[model samples]
Target: MELSELPSFDFESIIKSAVKKKDTHPVMDLPVDYEEFNLTSEFDRDSITAFVKSGGWAVGGYLEKRGVMYSAPRYADGRNIHMGIDIWAKAGEPVYAVLDGVVAYSTFQNDEGNYGGTLILKHMVEGQEIYALYGHLSKESLELHINGEKKKKGEVVGWLGEESENGNWPTHLHYQLCIEDPGEPDMPGVVAKENLIPARERYPDPRILLGDIY
Candidate 1:
């Protein structure tokens, strides 16, 4: 089946439940622009948690100014192009599988500003293979299963992690979809602006599976 034809998760329902329980901030509210406001200094774990608690979830960081953080010695222009949809929520919120797939990778990144507890699932649909990456997850999520394990659609796969374990950022889920194998437990969540076109071809918009949240 085409990517668009793949099964999708009821992200709306999940957000509704979270809002009702006060586990999340209001739905559809955009996060403060880190670029315009120069909120980089407050990008640490504590500050991010406070921001999410007060503002709700953030969407649309693709090619955003906050991409400056990811730009580094690795890229001459800096990889400020965000490749996923970040769902900011309370730590420990349960993360469910979006489709039936096998665990492709599960591990901790341990980098200061990286995906701490990460999980990558691989799925084959209509002879085409695809992958999903769930980053900054709670450490406990890694222990829930082993590599190659089969995960049914909508299964409880893991939970959001606190700053201590989730790469020292605010508790959130970095979800991405890949058309090609990332070739590792982790994939580049950001790329340089110059490479946006090609990179986008490899990693299509995750909303294809996440549904519309805008």
Candidate 2:
């Protein structure tokens, strides 16, 4: 859908409502010793995995402008602005729901640089609908639940996919949020420089829900 066609909302209000209804269930059982990884440049999978191992775990912040990592021929459109927070951990780490929601869509996208096995959940915060997209999940995750299934906050949803399953990236969870329903299991987790403004509007900073992990 065109960026112009996407619905707008009082993002602040939605965030406030979500905060008021905060569920402490972590999306992942991250370690207290976790550090943040700077993935703003191209790096091989081994490097990221090594970093994660060194830190016990690690996270990649949102909106980190990158280049070679997102360069073509995989990302042919020059989408280098990361719109999600990546939680780096060992492969097969279980992921949980951060909020109570209904499964909206699920699919396995096998293309390179894609989300691979993905799931999008629809949430209602004070009557305003929002979406959370879980990307780079294991192929087995697709069989864990069906579309329209209900998930409670903190419930086990899936696991981190292996490199062969998770679009050839290091083991991690690409967690993103949508102020408006993306209408699909997948949404653009990265965008070109020119689209940053609209992309920010559609995809708000997940930190509001994730809290100060940076």
Candidate 3:
């Protein structure tokens, strides 16, 4: 999983988890209510794509520059490939729960992309605890999430942030699927090349439940 190199997703492993956790799964019961960048001004979309393609400082880079090393540079490899999918969208956009779970971790990591404030929910489906991550959010999003508690299927966790706080590019949500305890209050939301094997093993691919979008 090099940053510039995309790897064939391990679907068999993903399927194994799905088969084992299908009944009462956290994500299955949770419904996604967020809006994708389906309506940015036509000009905006083109500009965003061009900027990211040019590749100076975009989504992952902003995080890296600030210190979230795991944003790129896979733990298994050094090319820095990304495993979690990033969906580009607009600011103030509504981000809802994709499943029912308790807010396990929430913080304003303003440190690196600091996830520009992030949230992680944990739950058990068919008995295994699973985690969900939401990143690059608006300031208000800081207050909107379920917090040290659980949220219903359609609750608005928060809105997307504008370019500035969201780490310089257009606003969007960087969601991930994790299987770890999500760390105490604060820890690495993204991992560098040193521990990716463990992260990927615990988290698996979120797209299996999220529906591939990158």
The full ranking of all candidates by lDDT, starting with the best, is: 2, 1, 3
Mind giving the per-residue lDDT tens digits that candidate 3 earns over 41-81? 13254566454344322222211212223332222333232
Q: In model 3, which runs have C-alpha deviations exceeding 4 angstroms?
A: 1-46, 49-79, 185-194
Report the lDDT of model 3 for residue 84.
56
Cα-based lDDT for every prediction: 0.68, 0.82, 0.55
Better of 1 and 2 by TM-score: 2
Off by over 4 Å in 1: 1-47, 63-68, 71-77
Candidate 2 regions with alpha-carbon error over 4 angstroms:
1-10, 53-55
Q: How well does each candidate superpose onto the true structure, as a TM-score? A: 0.73, 0.89, 0.63
Q: How high is the lDDT of residue 84 in model 1?
A: 78
After the best TM-score superposition of candidate 1, give how far the Cα of residue 4 lies from its true spot, in angstroms: 21
Per-residue CA lDDT of model 1 for 1-214, tens digit only, reads 3223334345423433432432221212233552122332334546657866664555554334353355334445566667777877778778888767899999998567788899999866545577889998988889987998998877888888888898777777888878768888887887765666666767766765665554
lDDT of 1 at 143: 95
Q: Estimate the TM-score for candidate 1.
A: 0.73
Q: Which prediction has the highest lDDT against the true structure?
A: 2
